[model samples]
Target: MTAGAGGRPGAAGRFASAVFGIAVLVFVLAPLLWLALRAFAGSWTYPHLLPSQWSLRWWSQVWDTPGLTSSIRLSLIITPIVTVLAMIVCLPAAYAIARYRFPGRQLVLMTIFATNAFPRFGLFITMASLFYSLNLMDRMAGVVIVQLIGTIVFMTWIPAAAFAAIPPSLEEAARDAGAGALRTFFTVTLPLAAPSILVAVILSFLAAFDEAQGTFLVGSPDIVTMPVQMYSLIGNYPDQVAAVFSIMLSIPSVLLLSLVRRRVLGGTIAQGFTIR
Candidate 1:
């Protein structure tokens, strides 16, 4: 209740806040710390709080392992492609859902939500059967299709909300200035919605990037993504190697989010998720 100098929180308030922040920081960082220690530790026997020896052997092993580099490359390639494809397919639908009042509208929205609402393994199993019939099994396209399923709700829901949030007056103003419908959309509407769309894009990219179960079921031996490779690392390699791979797998998401930290933290994401 007390204020310190310049009306800031008093000492006791600051201390409590600091303690809570530190606790949260530790809670979040502890797993990464454990993973880092395992990746570099040469011998960390039980009962020891720290490793007896630290080395880069596991890191080296991660780089030297067969198919690891390709998996990383595949992930880099696939996630971006999936993001773009999701935007291509879902963005228009998002715009339609946001702007138009058509038949079965709520059903469409609920259907999108339903994909993520239930358990996914059963869906993947059903999809695997379809892929087999369609000859999509073990193919890049099939993997992309599988990953796309993970991104649909994000790409659709967020951007649709973003588009819906925009004022019609802005687009009308652009149209009054002699801009055609498409031009008004590109100039006025798109820019206003861009922030939330970016949020959706990043979320979709991360969803596809981290997708593993469906990918493994569909692609198998031929298409090994980074997340799929994680299963192999955990099963076939030492825990240390798996830890190293885990860190590597995390790097892209960390860097991507870090680059857009401010934007993502801005109210755009909140606006996108808030249903009117």
Candidate 2:
């Protein structure tokens, strides 16, 4: 009749929580399930809870679509490039913000956050003319640069938080052991931050991989990426093609997440450090 000492939920409360969790899971997965079904459905019609038939014809069409191969290749090229460049640029900036108390540090972080708050379509549209005038339009370089604007903002914040969570004593101890600042960073700080940095790498890659607005504005037919190709396919083909494209788009992301599952789910940059 009495609640648990730790205030744990009663059986009815536990049942409610389980039901709520299941509902949330269904809410998230239902659309993906529907898309998977439609991707294989030969002729799904209204008023049917399931497909009348199933086949791989849509998948074959997806594979054979002109420019799809090139688009995928371009995405593979661009995503890594963007992720590496973003890490290079953001890591030091994030470290400085997290470790140092420089003037205007908060202001700089606020600006980065504000940049992400702008509507991406409007932001890309405004940059489109500037990119064109600079002769960067329709180029891979242009897409990478534009994509970096948003990705850097997002990627920077993640590592910044990770770095901030780290105890400064770890770096200080390394310094006490006769390590130079750079060596201390490379030896202690970076190792501790690796998990979060890996997370940032995966996220940066995904952001660049999935980016549509900036890529659409800056890239040409010659520089097509997967999202751009998918847009074209959806416009010219049936909805099934869109479903197929969604599955295709998701595969690499899913694989990347799987590869980093441990780090993403449980590991942290500074998980084991103690302040003593």
Best by TM-score: 1
Q: Please, what is the whole-model Cα lDDT of each candidate in the order they appear? A: 0.88, 0.82
Off by over 4 Å in 2: 1-15, 259-276
Residue-level lDDT tens digits of model 2 in 40-132: 888888999998998889889877877787788888888888888998888999899889998998788887878778999998999989988
The local distance difference test score of model 1 is: 0.88
lDDT of 1 at 247: 88
Instruction: Residues 1-276, candidate 1: write the lDDT tens digits.
Output: 333647768778899878988999999999899887898888899999899998888888877877998999899999999999999999999999999999988889988988888689899999999999999999999999999999998899888988887888888888888999999999888998887788788889999999999999999999999999989888688889999899888887997798668877776667655454
Give per-model TM-scores.
0.88, 0.87
- RMSD for each model, in Å, please? 3.1, 4.2
Clashing pairs in 2: none
Model 1 C-alpha RMSD to native:
3.1
> Which candidate should be chosen as best, given lDDT against the real structure?
1
